[model samples]
Target chain A: MPGPKIGRRGALAAGLALPFIRPAIAQTAEPYVMGSLFPMSGPSAEFGEAFTRGAQVALQHIAADNLLRRPVRLQSEDSQALPQPSVVGMNKLISVDRAHWVLVSWTATSKAVAPIGDRAKTIMVNGGAVGPDLAGLSPYFWNVIALAHLEVQVMVPFLVRQRNARRVALIYVDDPLGDGILGQLRGTLPRHGGELVGSFSVPRAAQQFGPVVARVRQTRPDAVYVASFGAQNAQIVKALRDNGVTQTICSYSAFGIDSLRTMPEAEGALFTSQKLDLTGAHALTSRFATDFRARFGQPPLVYHANYYNAAYLFGLLAKQVETAGGTVNGDSLRAAMLATRKFDLVGGEGEFDEQGNMLTQMQVNEIRGQQFVAIG
Target chain B: MTAFLLNLATLAAISGILASTLNFIVGYAGIFSVAHAVFFGLGAYGGAQVALLLVPDPFLACFVAALIAGGLSLCLALPALRVRGEYFVAASLGLQMVAATLFAELKPLTGGIGGLVGIPRPEIFGTVVPVLPLALAALALILFLTARLQRGAFGRTLQSIRDADSAAEALGKNVNAAKTLAVAFACAGAGVAGALYALHLSFINVESFTLDQSIQIMAMVIIGGTGTLWGPLVGAIMLLSLPAVLSFIPFIPPTEVGAVQQIIYGLAMTLLMIFRPAGLVGDQTKGRSTS
Candidate 1:
């Protein structure tokens, strides 16, 4: 009777202890730290903040789900929106903090850091660097943001075939960033049977713009494509209106909308974005927006959606690697992350091509009254 | 290969030429017009504008732009140059700020904030002379001319004004003319450099030519040694190379390194002023009278 009783008690103890063992092993799992180099304090400070918020919300969502096999941490440093600062920030993130993966901010910063990242054997994901010069150039780099030139391919066809645009004028920011966009327009517009009537590049920090306004107005273009950002864009739009050059205008990114938010005169400007509209009919986006708003006290931008997706993708890759009996080496994680397809992450169907660029389509938007409305 | 060397030489030459002219005004003439960048910017815009509006040839544009810059410099000099010492400095700085603001706000004309870009490079006959060869030739010409000017009567008169403006005035020498000419020369050099910069980078934006750039150019003169013909070269090299060197070090973030490098530069300048006030090749007597 005593032998049977002792056997039964031992069996019960073994059953209870089995569930605790895996988590104990999992608890000891090594955390993989993701490093971010962004322009937190410089020219693109607002965009940087939006990116941080996006990445943060995503990471928080993954942690809440206990979807990560190991602890995940994100550390960030300011790049000041220049090449040298980016190189330094990337070094500290990799050498000091031992980050295996890096997400760099902006096209210029990414272009600057590509050589450094290649030398270090670390994977770099570019958030906003959208120049075609970077594409297919480096194997180590992955551009998550759709490049500006690619938009010309998408936008020109749509405008020529769909909107019946013929004569177009381009107003660019007169830098490397604008140069890339200009190259695209030059190549694509002619092929699309649309004529580029005039092109103008402006300098930054210029206090007045009467003469350029006069020149742009002289062209009398049917459509004006503006490639600029921040207060400079605001000033240009204001100058365009003040100088009486009123034509249908389109901008590349949320810059025009961001400009309109501050400048009442720029209320009807149109732009494009990668983030799903919170006000859209998509159930997932609506649900995410509700949750995000409740947590952060505002609607989420596309940058936040990207961050959530990156975090989710990172965790999923880590889990897959752990299951495959492979260690979370930089190369291994990068390969696994790249191989991801039809991944129903937080931002919708996630995909990455051979160039490490995200394949998600962008949405067109126009600012009406005080809000951004989906155009298509 | 020759083309590359020429372009490199041209950039150094232009910087040197600009530096030499600035040396006369700041080092020898003892007028630290912080608005020197504005003059430089004016030359760039003027050069590009003249080339775009009047002449298609970059070389001819260079001349027209220089004349425009020189003419503008005189206009700026009349009211601003009358003040002595700190007041002059304040007035010049104000001009720089106002000019930069005008360039941005007056968008209809200046392309507000997006600087003039794609201004054609200097061409010989039908051949588009490569930047390197053109720059090298330009550098040689600027250097030769600067060397000649330094040994000329104008140079001596400019030095006299720098040594003692009152004395120079008492000697019946036109002090204002000397100062204005020195400014015009500096403005011309800056214009040439700006035109080349527009061509070389194949881009020009307002961000590249800021009040901060004016400050940097001034630092080049001060750090390299005031009034010395070679001062700007050494200073430009130091300022440019220091950041380049700091960029190579790992473990330190570039931004942090940049901040630290600036701090060290400030300390170095302070020490330079304290111990070797004459700078690397500065004459103590000249320093007292001029600097």
Candidate 2:
């Protein structure tokens, strides 16, 4: 944490040796290598695996189709979803691994890794970190997921229209992920003629939710919305029922699906998802879902959709750019990323805004029996 | 080669400070302070705030932030000191969770999950120092602190407290006061490191300082050697920098490579504990300094 100290003697000695050690470095013509870092062994390992699987698929597709014209390879690093490991992982990715592009996941790791990416001048793409302010921080960084700040704007309208909710209660983890969503809800909910009646805040990865559930039950709102992760959300749902709060509880994406597999109380929870229901045979959805199932040997989770789309988009962009006779260096690749006007993928057409937020529609679903059924 | 050295040096610098801080709590004071990340987070937030809000004199803000962090650590220590061992570890972990959540949710102050961005690097005495120099400066601070702590009577007293708090307390030493001071100093040092980390990366969030970080800090101290200065430096360089270096092997995919590295690290730690309980630079035995 302290700035690197320069001892008087050591500084002088280093100052003297600097002239001798100095040599203007020239750029080498090595093929571009990208590093994708994620939490592959810890709690976040599920998402990390999915992201890597997507990246791997994308890289394969690129190679199969000759997307970049000049063979580009990808190296994935596991930060174990922790800052120190991520920092360590990224250092290897850049200095040792020699990667040009670095992709990371989730808000926590992204926040830790972004600075490292910027310091190293590595082109960093965030597949999972969706905090709104992330885009404005560093030029080299961009996120594939929608910002948490936009959740209210994106979800409030849906909540008002689809769920027919008059009053809403908010239960969120007390961190940046929760804060961004809360900010969005505060800003957009009132505009949509809905009121956030009461709110509860819990710590991240909280195992016990009895007190938090008690706080939410006291609110007695018509609908309760929890912006939490899988395990925490599952615990909260159980607590909510135990407290006799019969309100329709909804959670933010993937929590419901991941929870039902672990916590049975998550049977009928409603949640928002960026991925559409591909259960039934539809052209784009069916192909992706079927392929994903074959590859991973299970139905694609919510985030898998984004990964699939991101990979496809990457291959598509690389091909188009290479076809245009542009090198897939940082500037050219960034231009290609920017040039993506409308990417018609599996679920919908994605139009990346100037901020690189892929403006696309999401689906709302409720767990009916054993599957996520599309609601309206 | 220079880049590799710089990377290794940077990891060592961070690890040294972290290990030193951990040593004060777990090594010297015999406390399982899990909330080490809180001080680290505070430093990061404080440093970033100082860099952004009180521009033109960010270094001044670093001290201010450290003071605030130290004060907060004292507040946390007052209640946490009541607990012992694993329970104490759990409590500290709870504190870390609570702090991180607050940092994320308290959007007005901490910038939420999107985190604070564009934190300006320090401009000490009107010179724009690059990251590597700043890294070297951090390493120097660690070295200085390590050496200073070794020579001082306060250091010996602290170690005595860790060695046997009951005996130390019986000898007319204020055990609680010593423990609290150790925690505070460790937190302050971690805070300073956090500030430097902010400057180096120019971005931060609550996610950066989680319970996992507390564990990592513990690992740095454990793997390096609790009381020695160079232990953390060695561990950090080896563990943190090794993965980065391995990422360059073209045949290994970065993701696969990362997993392999973790497996290797986990095995290394296990072997070190089983065969050499003293750790790389630790005292002769584990749990000897503290009971």
Candidate 3:
């Protein structure tokens, strides 16, 4: 005899019953494992430390209320700001730890980890990496922060409209992140009635920007757009100022408190960044900032907010999956995340496009005294 | 666990090939070339482009990459052969910087800072071999070929030239030709490794192949005991596997793991240098200074 009448009727019955059964099974405290790869001990160690603290704070927040039915566990690795280490970390996370979700920061590390995430069918949330290459790169990868080009798009218009910058000079670190910003500025400045007079790339470790500063000075552009970050940003700004080329200086979010502290001369510099005012408005932001300060004993960097947003997003996705009576695996969570139209994160009300790029507003901030005061 | 092991094994295999290639130059031909990774980058970029734009076949792409790397190494060997010792090293270092600049500037071919991604995985005879096993097979083949070369007359000529190039020239040996051939062969090995690495990672950038990588390869040869057949393999295994093993230790915070691993690695290398200057497997009588 044939199969015992297990046709459409039985299949439909099983399909209908699966949803009811799944939630009960999922509610049984199945451990949700998250693996994070950060540059915890390399050139970008400061940012990595901030990212770790963000993850910790996010986890603590989740654990407080038991946000999901399952207990969440985080297994992290230090990527050392290098591709090889990031790859190794990704492999261990995917193959050994069996992490359901992976978080990565930094352009190089994210680029290195994206292919692995695609192959392993795991969802990778890029918290801080904003390289232009990440746009439409992978369905498995989601960039929580705005793409570099998008940030430049926002910054350049502000420069043209508010700053009234016509001729621009570009100075960037010779790396993917810097290159991405420069590429965007070149394409964007022309459309905004601005001309790129001079463009120069300094080596990543070059402390002496004398020649570069001299070259930029010769051009006498309306404003100088710099793409260097951290200590490099301070160094470049100081070099430019010391050379007496006092054209209105502007940069990407790279001009942070660290850079400002190092080069007090950069007090009047203008830059565009994701609105990171912790005490300004959003309750979540205020709570996160307060808790972070209490725990880490220092103000959270903008990168910390990015990672904190990632962890929060992960929880939101897991909650959505649970509510929909679905298994909390990579595929399901990714689908849930993509389907989400908006999320109230610490940064702001953020939305993601189909390409997993977060669409958020960037505030133009001016360094006033020792703090970054939002101008626009 | 299996995937982690496979990844570690693949990394070791790639490192082993690089170490072996460096050994051919520094151990056999006595050329202090620090531009080895430049050739490796060329192979990776060339193979990646070939597979991406020219041919879909990974093996053919790898072969083309090897040929390109070998040819490029031969060209470098012509000028490099004029110098010796530390001077040669400086020349190689300069060459490396130039190659890096080219890799960064030639955005059309190399993809510049964005790098070439979406490289197709290796497929053989309608079957896709797992990258780990393919890497291991490549390692085995390279080791076998290296061993065979060491046993032959070519290897003897290389040793003589390494020891005393002027003396070898006086004895009617075509010293220039031998140096060029040695560089070509060694670079081919690096090319194969690079190709395999590109295929395995399915992504490559200028950052992966740098002076740092060349230095790391040289360190592997030194630590494993150069001039011996098994030395590079041992060194590659040790260097590649140590970090993975250390990562498993409990109580160390994840944030501090990388720094701790680096400290341990540095300490191990320092102690080895202090205790065994000739290296773990190198002959004490044939010290580095003697050559």
Among all candidates shown, the one with the greatest TM-score: 3
Q: How far in Å is the alpha carbon of B20 misplaced in model 3?
A: 0.9
Q: TM-score of every model? A: 0.59, 0.81, 0.91
Q: 1 or 2: which has the higher lDDT?
A: 2
lDDT of 2 by residue, A1-376 (tens): 8998889899868645543331222134355566777777666666677777766655655676665656655666777666656766676667765676777776656767676676666667776666555665466676666666654566677778877875888888776567667777777778988888888887666778778777776776878888776356677788888778788887666453444644556666777766576765546567677767777687766666676666566667667767898765556666887876677666666777775567677666777766777684
Candidate 1 per-residue C-alpha lDDT over A126-200 given as tens digits, one digit per residue, 9 for 90 to 100: 666565556764677776666777666677776677668778888887555677778888889889998888998
Model 3: CA > 4 A from native: A1-30, A174-180, A190-194, A203-207, A229-231, A257-262, B284-291
State in Å the error of residue A205, model 3.
5.2
Q: Per-residue alpha-carbon lDDT of model 2 for B37-143, expressed as tens digits?
A: 78878888887888788772446655765787787887567854576677887777778878877876777777776577667777878776655565566567757
Q: Assess each model's interface with DockQ, reporting 2 decimals per model.
A: 0.03, 0.26, 0.28
Fnat, model by model in order, equals: 0.01, 0.45, 0.52
Local error of candidate 3 at residue B170 (angstroms): 2.1
Predicted structure with the largest lDDT when compared to the true one = 3
* Model 1 lDDT tens row, B56-171: 46676567657766778775567545786888877877887788777666655565543454455556576666555554555567656666776898777777877788898899
Per-residue lDDT of candidate 3, residues B119-209 (tens digit)? 8777777666767776677778888888898789888899999888889999989888889988998898898888888887888888888
**Model 1 misplaced regions, further than 4 Å:** A1-31, A187-193, A204-207, A254-257, A279-287, A310-312, A345-347, B1-291
